[model samples]
Target: MPEIMSDTPTDFKHFIRIIGRGQRAGRTLTMQEAEQAMSMVINGQATAEQKGAFLMLLRVREETAEELAGFSQAFRTCSLASVADLSVDLDMGCYAGKRRHLPWFLLAVMLLAKNGKRIFLHGTHEPDSKRLYLKEVLPQIGFKVAQHPEQVQVALDTFGFAYMDLKQINPQLDDIIQLREQFGLRSCANTLARMLNPSHAAHCLQGIFHRKIDEKHRETAALLNDANVLCFRGEGGEVEFNPLRDVTLHVSRNGQQSSEDVTATCETFITKPQELDAKQLISVWTGEFDDIYANHAVVGTLSLMLVLVDKLDWTEAYQQAEQMWQGRDKKWPVVLPEDKSEVVPFDTTGKHYAH
Candidate 1:
């Protein structure tokens, strides 16, 4: 048996050696071992070589549910301030999708807020390799990212929306991003990062790309006991209506789980952009695509929100979302080439503007 260190290892060299040995032998890390390894990485004590090894091991094979649970608990312990008084019924972890469709997450959050629902939206915009992120776009829609947990609550109370940047809220976790890039592929960290719910919100809306991760996400949330999570194989990994098909919504709420097939089979709801020689499909997503797509996303969101608030029903929620969509006079802001004309290179030190 490799002797377990009594004091937490302060450097990445030990982390790499431990994780690599476990991976090579086809062994899994104990929950304790996993937490310690991650803590070393997050706390910036790991050496560069160890950081790469740890991330690669996790990338080659996913984390076990036990390990994931341990990591989540450790993360909460190391980061996140206690805000026991604030009750966040919903926390939406919005990943920037492959197809940069107009960010429906923001729209959904706004609608939920208008209806008097408390919500928290948490994410980061690093590895800006492709697609626009909420961290970059929320300001365009008139929201600012919260600087602290208290600010998050205040924003939720006042604006119905609160943006929590992973870096600002948990600098320790943020430190691992650069090291994560060294591995050149998304490992468990990418998945785990989305699962970070700082608000300790009992309800979550998580969007993922891989189908396998969906069940794991459910198990992870169930482990937390208090969380009622909805995991969607999002349209390109973000919450947007798929132009090619109806969206698949997999919901796990109140310990009961179900899935709804939301395919866009109607002609009114479907459009052939290629035939129209539409240079891009951008116009439709920004323009009115269909009442159903809008309603589906809203109801899907509300279903998660409803899990938090006992008074809301699916039918009533859908109707409410439809009313909101109909009331909008103009199309939501969809990013275009012109939108990027003024974008300064992401300044690490400069303040982030939402647009």
Candidate 2:
């Protein structure tokens, strides 16, 4: 048995014991225990072996809402709590890298930001080159990726929206997210990062590729007691919905659970963007190019959040989103990097794990 003497530094051993017993022998941790365990990991008190064992053990079993909330709480406790007191209206989680689409959701967020909605977007770019991640596309489209919380504040102040890298919010958890390449499996880090809501924004929007994870996000939001949360199976596992398909969203507003469906409004089906060029995002935003699939995708995703925040009703939300998209600023300062040589090249092995 692992020693458990009082005042000893063996809390991780205890956590491992609880989570890593033979599949049938182990049980899930209580909410408090889960929070403590995650805290230990984030604070760097746990060894790498212990972190791997604990995360992999939890991955084998789906995490409970209680466990997710506890883990998020631990991360929130350690995240940079102060961010220059910027007024943020939404916490957008964008973890799933785009594979089949051009991240039309970026255009949607930009539209909202232009309309004076302070959107705080945070995500990790998986090290895969075959897929287009937001961080890689942001620069190409003349948007800045924030490396720190203060920069996030500045971006929000300047453009009413900002994209933040999860690594900046918490490197320890980002390190765990990177472990996907080594373990060949995604652990709870991906899920937990979505719930970070580091800025404690009242409303959170999450997109996942799987339906089961959609429900998990909804339930976890309730556990966190967030005022508003909207989640659904989004395009390519992002928060962007496919305009060609009816999307059923799980929502938590004011601690109440509800479901809403954004019916397909497009006449044609589009499995992928017509073009994958990063410049196309800017062109779409500037009205240089018009695409039915991408247009409705932006409107559909914006409407979901508009309704979730009680800013508008379903019908009104769609109408308003369309109007917002139609009137978006075509010339929102595009500052390209002077030197493109510093760009990180992505690995093109293309073995994407199920997000």
Q: Model 2's lDDT to the true fold?
A: 0.77
Q: After superposition, how far is residue 147 of candidate 1 from its true place, in Å?
A: 2.5
Alpha carbon deviation, residue 349, candidate 1 (Å): 28
lDDT of 2 by residue, 1-355 (tens): 1112233346579988977787798888877777877877776678888888888888887788888888887777666666425578888888888766678888778777777789988888665324667887888767789988788878998888898888887776788888987777788888888877777787888888776788888888887788888888888778887777777888876667877766888888555533366777777777788878888889988888787665476799999888988876687566666765654444434454557
Model 2 stretches with alpha carbons more than 4 Å out: 1-9, 22-24, 128-130, 271-275, 335-351
Write down the TM-score of every candidate.
0.74, 0.89
Candidate 1 per-residue lDDT over residues 300-354, each given as its tens digit: 5554355335435445655655566556434433233434444433222323221
lDDT of each: 0.59, 0.77
Can you give the lDDT of residue 351 in candidate 2?
51
- For all candidates, the clash counts are 7, 0
Determine the backbone clash count of candidate 1: 7
